[model samples]
Target: MTALGPAASLRDAYGAALVELGERDPGLVVLDADLSGSTRTQLFGQRFPDRFFNVGVMEPTMMSIAAGLSLGGRTVFASTFAVFAAGQAYNFVRQSVCYNRANVKIVATHGGLLVGGDGGTHQMVEDIGLMRGLPGMTVVVPSDAATTRAATFALAERNGPAYVRLTRESLPTVTDGSFRIGRAAELRSGNDLTVVAVGALVARGLELADDLARLGISVRVLDAASVKPFDEAAILKAARETGAILVLEEHSVLTGVGALVAAVTAEGHPVPVRRIGVPDLFGESGDPWALLDRFGMSMQRIRDEAWDLLRLRGRVE
Candidate 1:
């Protein structure tokens, strides 16, 4: 069986795709807010110097500039850290991108507290919640590098404002390139319980799938990457098939992806769903893996939760 975590990280794939996309579309322009190197847009900027713009430390202005470029018939991808992309540029995105419904894409890096040593200040746990709340905005969190690359290309074809979040560290790519936005991708099939996750947590679900499969417990895993315009059909179907659901995420449980998934599931399926994510509190300075383990966001925790949920449903040993 193939193991998780040995694959290339999504950050590298995202960076390489930024360059490839720039080469493919002459109208493809990249804007970085003084974080070209850290956000990894520098790789693209180096190749397409004329097409890439460094707008200094101003993230809000960067968003506006991107919107303006889009209005002028250019496809603009504004890159920045998640905190500034969502927090600092919130108004620019809401007014210029969403209000105008511009076809600009905002690519956020270092999303979630997994940003590690950089600590709480740089981490953006609320980015998904922030973008998901915007009107005319499509929020996506790719499970890995391969999927993130596909998402970047897919954004060129999508209309309206799009927000795609990426991580700073490398994550295993569990999805094998057949990702459709707003449609949940099932990695495992089970009749006992369903584990719905997005972004980095998808790896956790995959790991849990291996464990549960070994114990003769049927476990289903779904990668619900698109947050806004979510796949309600896939979610409800999973609930009906498994009889219960578990939402796993790297963001806060309050106002995070898990909450939105629960709300939608409750409305459509009304099935019992447990949420696994960061608690309603700020993160501390620590190793990313250690912090996730403590907050019940690790693969081990996901596996444990799946087992517990199946037992609660009386479907496991």
Candidate 2:
């Protein structure tokens, strides 16, 4: 694989990618709930002012408008903060988007405690958990800028309700290759343990795998970018082959990707699984990296958790 440097932030990548979508499809319209610049939809607004609609700060109303547009043969991409997407538009998305099965893509930025310094009010650590519970909704958290670009284009092409969770800070670009939705990408091949990671934590998981390999612990890391309609067959195969699995994420541990993986593995392969993510608590105002370390989202934490799970699984198997 080619070496990757620092990737573009989700905001930047989303803006550019959405603009490209607009260039390709005339029906592609963007709706922002008074966060055009903050969510980086301002780029689209600049390019196609008529196509971009800013419906004040009212999230629910914006969702309804987007759904109506979709029904009228328009592909709507609603941009907002994760809090507003999963909070204010909760009922609207459930009814207008998911229930009606509209082709609306909800692009939410500043997800997780990575939205640091904004405190608990802005950090959307539970957004994925909320969105994942909705019926007919495809939840995706692209690991980096490249993946986010691919996901943005993919969501635009697909017709249905899809929720995209993006981060506030820039992250390492681990994958420069294109990714297919609902397919897990194998970062490393190892039979000792499988580390299944999603979103921002994927880079850390891959680093942990490399570090563990130096310690004679072969680690398999899979990037589960597409959360909903999760690649259960791939996950089960990893568990049955490796006998242990560790799911990592930047969101809360409960009802998030970790819980979903645990549920899937328990029902199928019945292997020992460990979940590393934010505990059931709000994050305080702090630097993003420090907060990630505090909440066990660091590469070191992943390495330790994988080792611990490997030992436990070894004893069981």
Candidate 3:
């Protein structure tokens, strides 16, 4: 609803939200694979030590335990890096949690190139695709701290398997606290082209819209927070109204929200779509912002792609 004032860490908001949830719901329990400090689950662990389980570095074991706890009538929140939670423990999550439709919330932190100095090994850009592929799993990537807090609470209340991808770097608050899973928020409206963004790229999408506006290009921006069970209505509306779309994300362009948006539009509207994100390659150690720029996730790349797509559609010269 309003422009972002200052950057706030999503992981910080996640920890606070977990503490609040612990206070409100005694049925809630948390498990971490020794990454509670980085993943921000330590706040919950400190406040509700009895309800928290530090399962060492065994991510799969933690996932299995979470599934068991869920079966025992407790809403479980498991924390770990995106790579471990969605990549390493994927099989366990698929069979143990998703198969039984366990009420488990896998809140993964340090997703994408935002891990910065941690390099490619720790920075997970494919977790969204992995989690989204699982049957009966709800995937969410909140853009900022406020939305992260909202998503955390929403996942805690909802039943079944869910993955909330979070970033390590701080992000400006772009949401107004009105967050609903499976629904996208339209930040800017225009008719020339639609820019659909997820996670950390939403703020860049908004800035892209502003810059394009100054250049006489009317671009609409849609925050695709809910990767799984995506906002089909909003996407289709943008395709129909704008006639062209560009999908932006911090993950790989191959299997992230861009791929999903393209598939959805191809089936329903058949509009010209372009995807901007990390390439199908591993990232190296560097400043987070530099990595984003190098991987073509920056506003410049988005602007270039928008212009290219518009030209292809004969909307620009």
TM per prediction: 0.96, 0.96, 0.97
- Ten consecutive residues with minimal summed lDDT in candidate 3? 1-10
- Model 3 TM-score, all chains together: 0.97
Across 1-317, the per-residue lDDT of candidate 1 in tens digits comes to 35764666666777798898887888888999999888788999999899899999999999998998898777888998999999998999999989988889998988887888888888788888889999889998998887888888888778778999988778886888777778888888877888899888888887777877787777788898878778888888988888888888888888777798789878888878888998877777788878788777877667677777787787866
- The Cα error of candidate 2 at residue 4, in Å, is 4.7
What is each predicted model's overall lDDT from 0 to 1? 0.84, 0.87, 0.91
Put down candidate 2 lDDT per residue, 1-317, tens digits, no spaces: 23446767878899999899999998889999888898889999999999999999899988888999998778899999998999878999999889988989999998999889999888888888999999989989988988899899988878899999999888888776577888888878888998898878887787787777777778888999889879999999999889998998989999799899999998998988888999999988999878999887777777677768877877322
Poorest lDDT segment (10 consecutive residues) of candidate 2: 1-10
Which clashing pairs does model 2 show? none
TM-score, model 2 to reference: 0.96
List runs of model 1 lying over 4 Å from the truth: none
Candidate 2 local Cα displacement, residue 5, angstroms: 2.7
In candidate 3, what are the lDDT values of residues 170-266, reduced to their tens digit? 9988888678998999888899999999888899888888887887888889988988889999999999999999998999988999999999999
Query: Which scores higher on lDDT, 1 or 2?
Result: 2
Pitting candidate 1 against candidate 3, the one with the higher lDDT is 3
Q: What's every prediction's RMSD, in angstroms?
A: 1.4, 1.8, 1.2
